[model samples]
Target: MAETGLIQSRYRLIELIGRGGMGEVWRALDESLGRQVAVKRLKPVGPQHDRTFTRVLRERFRREARVAASLQHRGVTVVHDFGEDEGVPYLVMELLDGQNLSQLLEENEQHPLPVEHVVDIAEQVADALGYTHRQGIVHRDLKPANIMRLTDGTVKICDFGIARLGHDIGMSSRLTTTGLAMGTPHYMSPEQISGKEVDHRSDLYSLGCVLYEIATGAPPFDQEDAWAVLVGHRDTPPEPLRTHRAELPGFFDRVVLDLLAKAPDERPADAGDLRRRIVLGRTGEQPALGPGPLARPATGLPPAPRAKALPAWTRSMTAGRPATGSTPPPAGRPDPAAGLTGQWTAATATAPRTGSSVPAGPPAPDLLATLEGRHGAGIDLGRLGRWAEAAEVHREVAAERLRLLGPDHPDTLATRYEVAYTLGRLGRWAEALEIYQDVARARAAVLGADHPDTFVARYEAGISLGRLGRDTEALEVYRSLVEDRTRTAGEADPETLRARHGLGVSLGRLGRWEEALAEAREVCALREHTLGPDHPDTVISRREVAAGLGWLGRWREALVAYRQVAEARTRTLGPGHPQTLAAREDEAHCLERLAQA
Candidate 1:
């Protein structure tokens, strides 16, 4: 490749950033987009090499580049473009302005990284593994040099679906007759050394080696000889992580050990589970993984969702409009002194109401339409984050519907449901609980107990119960709802699955972690099969599995699960979304657990 020239008339090579056995990585500019990019220039085969081998290499390069380009994720490096410039195949990727783990270790003078940073990186790598494995792609080579950590705290795995080229094509002659030394020997798994089939588990083992080195300042078997390192991976049991760093968290120590297991079966099930363990380990010490207390139950009957007090709706209205003692009423408006209150006289006879009727017929037909219009306006307000205004509008509509259509009317109950939702959005859990219960009861009576509308109301009631620390009540509600939903809509319905998810959450809250794990795993599998793994709801179910694993004292698996969720949420939803941040928070909590343990 030319030293300082344009490639394909689009990528202008600026300077060589790094070089490896297979290629040189250059800092370059994408003239088409006015952005920086990293250009990988594959080493050219010698003129004397067989045509068939060169053709095979070029084909493999194109196939791998295509696979890498197909990956659209935050945890994997983004490939911008790929092409051949004068027989030198090149790949253009998003220029990462951060150091790889190898660089970080060197910057730290070959010392171990901070415990928090080590766990964080472990979580990220595990998450990336989950995504890649799900796509039926194995990284084949995972080492410190292939993992990059950005300045914004984003960790990405590079050379996805293409690292094998470095070993298989670029350095084929370096391989011995026995077929050893395909990947960095320090991080190679036992199966890789034995020249047997490898899978995602092999990547886990390699990641273990990376985690061990980052946490303890050296790989598990840091032999100077490459062959000895390969042999050590196959035959030798690694020394305990604590042996090198006694101050390291015991939870982390156990996780690293599990990852280093020679047999793939002995490792965590997958990256999802690994992240979950990390989350649980870090947060296990807490009574609850998050805010919100579980309310104590009342005697006898199942604890009813409580309504503590009404929100201060009047406060906002009266804040700056205090009445003056001497203020007079506006012109033509009824004055208090002019009314019967001043004379204190009772009327001798009630005035006849001319327009009043004996029968209280259904409210004027136009009232329903007017109420619906107001309801829509309230929904629009809520969407704009004006929850207070929305709540007031919903409250007024609900009251009017009750007065005109009766408590059991679907429209009235629906309005009440909205009021509850708005109250919850305003953090008025008690008020929300009251309204949700009333709505649920009314809906159950008007529209059968198993009706979808009733189920929705009941679901909201359960959410309110959970918010007010009445998780036992919430659990009971969810359990009953699940059974009802299964009977009504079958086990595979999304609503049924939702109820099952709630039941799992409630179980977790009650500290029945083993039961919770079973429930969560069951729901996750079903969701994966029915909704697809990448669906937001399915991702949530996976997160629950991690939570259950963490609570069950499986820190390593929990860490993996949490990391997978965090990464998925960051991909499907933006990193700044509340759900994504929640996943990230769990990951951080797991790291903290490892640090303290």
Candidate 2:
């Protein structure tokens, strides 16, 4: 729209990328940033005179841009800037050097992408969407054209032009006010085509449609007419991928089907977790278990060429880097221990049982990581939760500590402790227990078993055991943990209180009501003193005391405890929430029990 072969000579509008129903993508040089970026522009600013139509069109683009920019994840497209150029609003995003899956499929119609590659891309896309959903955002449209695959093979999701956000856009959707259908018919979830309020799981359903295409080279439901496609998505059963790609991983095929379910609840609860599962499905060649940096070279694929030169101002913004660089820096602080080892005096000697001591030997955790090295974007592709990502990140940190400080370094063990704790968060109880036990043993050997770090790992091991559903085993673990933590951390410490709370939980699970109640009360009081009355953990301990009271047939006291939990959760977490609702429900149950008693 501008005379300078550019829009304001700031965005040198280069060649077009591809045109979609809502917008046209251009491979533009961001003269402001001195880097190449993709500019997605809406189709001719759609009928602005009719306020309602203008509102919907503008609002749609605006909301999508805002929400997309708000989210910062390596798997998601990086939105750099947004503004109006010559009467047309546009979005500036990281100029990814690769083809959209749509283009790849188009280029190779008969041969689908390799299953391993497909899984890798799918995991990244799902993880990105999963993170967005958790933040209360939903990608109303998820399709092949929106997913970008770099030559290095990392997937970046783009085009949130129609994404619905929890925040209010300048323009609101009356069509959406009535809740109308708005996604690609073939990729649309059944509930979405029917005009229902959507959430994160809806994105998962769309992901199923996309994954189905990746696996079989066709959308799950494709028809000659758009209407038929919509209807088919509503009623048709997707053909199983294994029917065509018999070599596909059976578990992954099941996971794809699980995402395609009609109801949101029927799909996986989180995209991050879905991504992790897909990641774990990869062959040995792919690194799917850890912290993911997003710097992979394009797979010998030529990037779409830029038509116009970036302006002098924009060139300055590039920080003098060449226009062709595609490596987006990895998220958070770069883990210093990317590829190195231990500095401790001895290779495997344990530190004393002293609390929090840096052993005289090499840092055991980093030493272990060095022994079993990890790399890549640290994208946690092999599990079903954010815990995978967290665990990997902590492991990476541990590795760096090992490399920088040496094996027996105190900082190294501290990082390893985090790794063990993070593993528990990911719901991998057996593995987490193993790691926790290892760290505890190491801490006890080097720092002394009575050290706070050793006791911490011991307590975590008990929690992990409980998560694994081994109540008797968990009970025994917790009993031991409580004793050790009490002696090492002291009864007044919050961690010691937490150990007591775990003991109470394990006791209750083992049907030892009296002991559970006694331990829980002690935990509640200690936590209140050490961590403050308002701390959520303290409140939870108090709630456990009530549950234990119920187990002992003390309904009145149980009701009191349940009421406190309900009120606290409502205040802290919010009402009508899944957790809050469950708490209130528990309160109701306790009240009913008291009435009966």
TM-scores of the models, in the given order?
A: 0.46, 0.45
Q: lDDT of all the models against the reference?
A: 0.68, 0.61
Off-target runs (Cα >4 Å) in candidate 2 are 20-22, 43-49, 167-181, 283-597
Cα-based lDDT at residue 570, candidate 2 = 68
Worst 10 contiguous positions by lDDT, candidate 1: 313-322
- What tens digits encode model 1's per-residue C-alpha lDDT throughout 1-597? 468899988899998998754467999999999999999876766653334334444654676687688777789998888888998999998999899999999999999999989988888888888887777667767889889999998999986533442223321111111122235678877666544446777788899999999999999989774434664675456899999999887878878887887656567767777777777777653223232112222332222112111111001101111111223433432232332222111210122124422125434447667888998898887766566677789889988866665555556667788888877655567888898788778656545565576677787788778667688999999899889888877898777887887787677667787888898899889988998877866776786677667666676687788777767867887764544544554554454355446
lDDT value for candidate 1? 0.68
Q: Which 10 residues in a row give candidate 2 its minimum summed lDDT?
A: 313-322
The most accurate candidate by TM-score is 1
- RMSDs, each prediction? 22.2, 21.1
